[model samples]
Target: MNKLSDEKPNTSGVLSAAARDARMTFGDKAKDQLKEAIEIVNATAKGLGISVGSTATAMLDIHSVAFGSGSISLHDETGIPLRGMGTGSKRLLTAGLHKEASKSKSIALIDEIETGLEPHRIVRFLKSLGSKDAEPTMQVFATSHSPIALQELSFNQVFIVRHDKPGGKTSVLAAPSDAQGALRATSSSFLAKSVLVCEGKTEIGFVRGIDLFRVEVRDKESVDAAGVSLLDCDGGSETRPFERAASFQALGYRVAVFIDNDRPIPEAEATAFVERGGALFHWAEGQSIEDAIICSATGSIVLAILEAAERLNPDDFDLLDSKIKSASGGKLNFEDAKSFAEMDCLSSEQKAWIAKAAGGKKGWFKDIGRMEALAREVVGPRFEDFDEPFKKVLKSIIMWATR
Candidate 1:
């Protein structure tokens, strides 16, 4: 470098006095280059039609570039990086990376396998794990409360842990066979000690309504608090309840069946279920659930129930009237159900026919929500106003729940 500091020209017109005085002694060695750059910039600003009197200034700081790599990252076409990926997507990506990176066998333990995944995605991700061929490639152990995740696994693959308060002991049992569909549909029942396996949505709604009535009017706790959970048989042939009940019983659950009397399950299966400590609850023979409930109602309550059902089925004109008329074999034919109100009253036999029509496939209150509303609005409020036998059957259920 040329040192002409003492004989430097009087170039104060090119720069201010402060700028001239600022460029002093050698700053060791490396800083001399920085000082030269500062002078060059200050000198060039004038030729470039720039003024140096503004608030702008420049300096060098070594510490500022210490962690510069933090700003460096690779991104996808849409400018999203690894940090921008969703948790579920990140997890799947990680699994895929592990699958490709590791050639040797490995063991993986994942907690809450359903975390950050949709139901269908969860199934697909799970199916990707474990053995690829007859010989195992990887082993996986996952914990989850999701029924969808559990449903994809077979019986022996799932283990349930239980605690016995009376004996101060714990037991781990494998899931039971023949219970995949039912167990997955009502997975919460697995946690309960008692399961009242009801036939279809109608029975489920009826029992739910009774539970509500028992709680609201009778001043009792809910069946849920009593460790009793209601299960649906998922509606199949007469043997579905028994098959599911037997499966739950094998899993150490106190099981019961609440079904219609239109078609009885095989006597041998019924006896076997009872012999295995199962409970059976049903209406008198030749009677479905609708028949048993409607035929037992008081005349005023019967009209109230009919009015509620008719109100709920307003879309179908003269619907209940047609069902009632056809159910009675033209003995109770009417232009509209409203005309039935003109009668002094309906006999028990006439109401039974109406009940039969209601239990049909296209009947009123066939849906779970509709049947649930029927119980809550009509049957639940008029609990004692129904026949004694109807009340007795409900009482049996309440006793079992509380016991």
Candidate 2:
């Protein structure tokens, strides 16, 4: 203290050495590295979806410091010390220091990397900790439950650790590469207790709409409240949803898949997935979602759906005239589809033709918005009126979600 009190203290060249260390520490390397790392921080922080400040960097900084023994203050800035910084800033600054130390082949451990940091900040903090590098300069073992952290990292860099209470066994399994696609798209599901892998946007929307329905009308618990996250496979392939769900099973995620029964998955793959504790949910024999809904729905409900389709998208979605006409063998020439729903009730043949037509590439209810509305506003209200086969599958889904 007495030595630092002097304007030009000559305490064994400590001030000069400290100044030199500060320049060495926060000089070129920090400038370049911090510049690159801060760019990531700025980019991720840009879309936090919340108003944090005037800018991402406004509330953030890196100050040069001098190591001082017995002194509470190490930062060169007057009256501001390490303790004065926010917890998130201190954690980030620690990562930066560890990054520099890693050049010396140091080892580091950071538990709960998301603690004291926002989602966007977690991303940049990982960057500072050498996570963005192909290979880290030093070995770092980190544990995080943050979805952003999982999103920023590849499957190869992640491991799922589980402890089974029955046997008191601890297992650490490396995440499969296929799971990375789901991780990138729905990162938050990695933190979910159960994952429902849907075949495409239609299923995802259906699940979301059903959850909303159960919560608002049915007076039941939500799927989200039950720790079930719905994932979209984007209609990848015949086995796409199953393959991804199998990957999740490998990661020890309680996995389930909702798919169309029109295409049969390979028996061997299906058996293996089931053996791995994956739950499979699909429409009845040779039935797609559209077919199942139409088959189970009453004539009036089907009429309502058609009316909504005509009212909402009469031009594009109503182009199903040729499809319906072709399916009906020209027996029911429902021109323009505008006149189809004017009747009191459609026959079984008409219903089948409508369902088949709706399953086409440009089907009316094939899109997420239309499917969501179908589940939430239309069919969900008359849940008790669906046929036994459709009700069975739908009830199974409800049971799994609420369980």
Best by TM-score: 2
TM-scores of all candidate predictions against the true structure = 0.73, 0.75
Please provide, for model 2 over 1-403, each residue's C-alpha lDDT reduced to its tens digit, 9 standing for 90 to 100: 4555536647757855766555445444544545564444434333322222332231112233443433222232232334566778777866765666455677779899898898788887888777778778867799988889999998988888889999999999998888888778888888888999898888887777777888898688899888998888888678778887877788888988899888876678778888888888999888889889887777667777777666556686437567777777877644533354455366676878888877768777777887888788877887788898898898898898788
lDDT of 1 by residue, 287-351 (tens): 78898888887666767777777677887746777777788888875343335533637776777
lDDT of each structure? 0.70, 0.73
**Model 1, residue 330: C-alpha shift (Å):** 0.9
Pairs of colliding residues, candidate 2? none
Residue 365 lDDT, candidate 2, scale 0-100: 77
